[model samples]
Target: MSDVHGRSSGTGRLVTVLAWALLLIGLWLWGRGVTGVPENPARPGTGDVAGLGTATVPLPPAAEPLGAAPPQRIDIPELGVQAPVMARGLDSRGAVDPPPFNRPDVVGWYGYGTAPGAAGAALMVGHVDTESRPAVFYKLSTLKPGETVRVVRADGRVAHFTIDDIRVLARDDFDAQQAYGPREPGRAELRLITCGGSFDRASRSYTANVVVSAYLTGTGP
Candidate 1:
């Protein structure tokens, strides 16, 4: 079934509204001011600050899809990142809750939504940086097309996804359907999200969000 965002339902509208509200709340909690739009977060002439370009890379034809299982760990070999996965729910404000600042090493999976490797989009979010130092997803913007992200499941299966695109969308352009909804129907997808772009000293928040889009390409034991 298509997700609520794809349909013309009241719930879908609510989700979209809540999603956008959460974006603002997240920025606020992370130290960004609600007033005044800042410049694009990414450096000029590299990737545009508004959006990241997308590429259609097919998953490995031989790979089999896995059943729904909670993710236990995540490994990005190219980035040398290996961290435990923690299930996180939305806050009272209906935003995807982030891991505590004290545990910068942990990544939060949107537990209320589709699990990783399931036949839908799975979301995982991390901090770009803590108040004092870099966080688990500080290098999220560095991920390139064709890289792989492996999510080990509680059932002992690993769902491997291929990076298809990376985008840094300004807060004003943040789209719930694009950021949190499914990319392709019947395909298992993954989104690694974190704050990005230039840090706005005046606002005390990052001006944009770095979103890495990937699709299930293969699986492992």
Candidate 2:
């Protein structure tokens, strides 16, 4: 399939093949207790204990107004993704749980963490593909730096964010902070994450993760 740019490029083909391979591997891993899969690690809560006996530091306060409800929907015009957001938490391994294959159209928000439009970085994860087809965030990498991501909140407000950066981190070197860190201190931010880059048939997993970082730039009704 062609990318959002309508370019029949080789990269697009690789992405397609890798997507299917990734989903297959992911399903296989899920059945086997998620062992040996290149899964992204769970992000720690901001300013929380690093380990045992560590001094506690306070996290930055939310920048949004009081009572900004949880995100109900996410819309990315450039990628043509409009999906309901479901709250997801950590799995047995403490890694963020992704949406199940049965609901490929849904997105998973790290509900235990800051809500989108709240202070700090709000994380949302989605599958790059399903068993036989591309899923909600299949074209996530096609998003450009200047694009906008709109999140409709349960409260009647829409949080508008401007894409600041995008990174593809190899699973071997994935850093939780880079994926979950607030781009600017005390500012509300969002991170859209999915698997991308090369797929490893031997390991049965994708080699990298695509993390899109955006910061709150405006708001709407």
Best by lDDT: 1
Tens-place lDDT digits, model 1, residues 102-215: 888899998756688877778898876655566788777877777889999988889989888888767756665666567777888898977776766666566677779888
Model 1, stretches more than 4 Å misplaced?
1-52, 56-64
Compute the lDDT of residue 64 as modeled in candidate 2: 52
Clashing pairs in 2: none
C-alpha TM-score for every candidate: 0.76, 0.71
Residue 52, candidate 2: Cα error in Å is 38
RMSD of each: 6.2, 16.4
Residue 142 displacement (Å), model 2: 0.8
Q: List the residue pairs that clash in candidate 1.
A: 41-197, 41-198
Task: Quote the positional error of residue 85 for candidate 2 in Å.
Answer: 0.4
